[model samples]
Target chain A: MTTVFKKTPVLTDTVMHYCPGCGHGIVHRLVAEVIEELGIQDRTIGFVPVGCAVFGYKYFAVDCVEAAHGRAPAAATGCKRVNPNNVVFTYQGDGDLASIGAAEIVHAAHRGEKITTIFINNAIYGMTGGQMAPTTLVGQKTTTSPYGRDPEHCGKPLRVAEMIATIEGAAYVERVSVDSVPNIIKAKAAIKKAFQCQLDGKGFALVEVLSSCPTNWGKSPAEAMDWIKSDMIPYYPLGVKKDRTNE
Target chain B: MVSKVTIDENRCKGCGLCVRACPKKIMQLSKTKLNEKGYHPAEVIDQGACIACASCARTCPDAVITVEKE
Candidate 1:
């Protein structure tokens, strides 16, 4: 058979530990393809956060550094500064980014750190057994919120992309999903642009991907993807939120 | 017109995302067979109708699906 779609070399042959249907695998491939397409694999430095993707170092065939929960931005900033020629990026989950690492990511963007951040927002925290994350939707029941997420008690879900776009140092911010082929294609383009923005030294670029958590959300892989389409997109909304690179 | 879709059984996690992704609703998970991964991988039920849309390959998290258009 004639070859059409094959795995990218940037991804290691190691089998991924991600739960089947989780969005991490798709996002990882997109990031790997972006790096190889840009020819920066030789000098790319990845910072994997403490989440389901904590072991991301083993999956990507590139230099990787493990960072504490919510500390990837800090590590990525230092990496980019010390090795200015190298491309530095971070892979973080909603719990790791919007909650614990919120301060670090905000400061990194504030400082105009020349690095890219691949933020995966599945709403509920994974790996830690489906705890409610900062991005969890209202009334969405999680392990931590058995009765559903109450807005009066928990306040509203944080819109990280919209909030980050206001920061003066942010170069690019876009939210995409992987529920369908068209959306997945858009996600690849957004991811590529985020990396390019960093390569061009624009500033701190972030691609907030609204991902699916089938195992955690107590839904089939297909239902989880549908959840993203019906619920997540309404609140998160897709497309670029900011682009200071044009300036 | 001939087209084909193949799955790398070892890498397949039996996620079933590809089954939902198929526009023609032709993909299904094996009920009686398991791959080396201990999971039943997806297979095409109506190979002749496959348009080589590659939607299954794109939605597959493991990148195990390969599509060829002829």
Candidate 2:
């Protein structure tokens, strides 16, 4: 029998610590698959952020570095600069990327660091007991925003993909989700492209994945997927926000 | 052509994504059995009905499903 689907070897045998149905597991698999398919596992380096995926290094078989909160991009930049021949990427969540690491990510992209970033924007902070993150939707209730996020007080959700796309050094930027089968395929393709951008010596590349935090959202895993389609998509439209590889 | 679906019971976290992704509705979580993790692992209700589209394997967050076709 021909195998239609199998787990990628780039992922270690370690069972992920992510919650059941958490988007982090799906994204983690896609990143591992990409690395395996590209045959870059031997020379790939991943920078894991301080969030729910803090144990990312344990899951991915490639060399990894744990960065300070919201400092994945900065650490990734240094890694890429030091090991110009190796593939470098960062796995970060909204709390780490859009909030604490905002300046770090922006500056990394602005400088056109040769690295890829897999940004998981689940709209709320998952690791910290579902606190409101910078990307939290207005009127969305979280532990910190009990009555729903108030735009007057929180301003609004930060569109990291669009914000990073505007920077000159960002060579490729796309926003995708894992709420459905087709979207999952597209998300994987976008992730591959982002990694490819870095492999080609192109500047910074980031793929913002609109993930789900079922535990924090206080919804069933299925309901969380629907919420991503019904609510999150409206605010953070999916598409390629920027691409300079063709230029 | 016949298709085969395998689920690593212990690895499954009972997310039910495969149950939802299966176009044939053959995938279902075991109601009477729980894995070592205490989660009801997913299983195929009717192996003959599986089309081997790998949709279940694709959507599985835990990567517990493996699809093969002959």
Candidate 3:
């Protein structure tokens, strides 16, 4: 039998540093696979932030950069501006993207930077020991919001994909998840399209993936996947939030 | 028909997410085996009955399993 499928060559031999049930690994593989399929490994540059995936540069065989906290988008902007032909993207978590680096991403998308971004929205912050992030759902209990995120005190969970879709410079914006096999396929397709938007010189593209944080969510790996279906999907929804490429 | 699922013992993190994802219910964690990472790697129980559905491989967070069909 032929080798129908296996780990993409884009990933290195180093085992990921993510938690046991974390979705980062799955998403990473998808991104690497997409790069491999597109034959852009040599030209791709991934930027990671100062979170659990800070060492993401080591995981992928592509040339990757470890940017400061919440600065991945800004860093990608610089790289794309200098090397317009390079395929640049950022792998950012909710806390890093929706919180600290909000302005960076906003301006980057607003300027229609020709780059792709993979946004992992697992609600709670994973790298910092489960703190309440900007994407944390209301009533979600994080380390920072021990009693449960109180909407009365803090605002509701940010709908990042929707918010970014409103910006004119963003050519493609889609929200997908890895909660199941079918969803996983859809997530990959969305990610591929996001990258294609940039490759075609359309504009900014971002695929917001609703991922799992099992360890931080105080749930089993299986339960975390289920949680994405029950809680996360309802809030984030699933589909193309924006597609300016065809227009 | 012959098919089996091969898992990279060392790369497996024993998360059991694939165990739940497998529709055939053929995957199990090795209680007697531990990888270099100190986690029990996943194992196949009924390799002969494997259909190479790849659900296990798809659900694996680590990309640790490879399903072969013949």
Per-residue CA lDDT of candidate 2, range B1-70, in tens?
A: 7999999999999988888788999988998999999999999999998889999998888888889999
Task: Itemize residue pairs with steric clashes in candidate 2.
Answer: none
Please give the range of 10 consecutive residues that has the lowest summed lDDT in model 1 chain A: A1-10
List per-prediction Cα lDDT, in the order shown: 0.93, 0.94, 0.91
lDDT per residue (tens digit) for residues A1-247 in model 1:
6767778899998999999899999999989989988999999999999999999999999999999989999999988999999999999999999999999999999999999999999999999999999999999999999999999999999999999999999999999999888999999999999999988888999999999999989999999999999999999999999987777
Model 3 residue B42 lDDT score: 90
Residue A172, candidate 3: C-alpha displacement in angstroms: 0.4
- Give me the runs in candidate 2 sitting further than 4 Å from their true place: none
List the candidate numbers ranked by lDDT, top first: 2, 1, 3
User: Which structure among the candidates has the greatest lDDT?
Assistant: 2
Give one digit per residue, the lDDT tens place, for model 3 in A42-135: 9999999877778889889999998999999998999999999999999999989999999999999999999999999999889879999999
Estimated TM-score for each candidate? 0.97, 0.99, 0.98
Regarding TM-score, does 2 or 3 come out ahead? 2
Off by over 4 Å in 3: none
The regions of model 1 sitting more than 4 angstroms off are none
| TM-score of decoy 2 | 0.99
Candidate 3 B-chain TM-score: 0.94
Model 1 steric clash pairs:
none
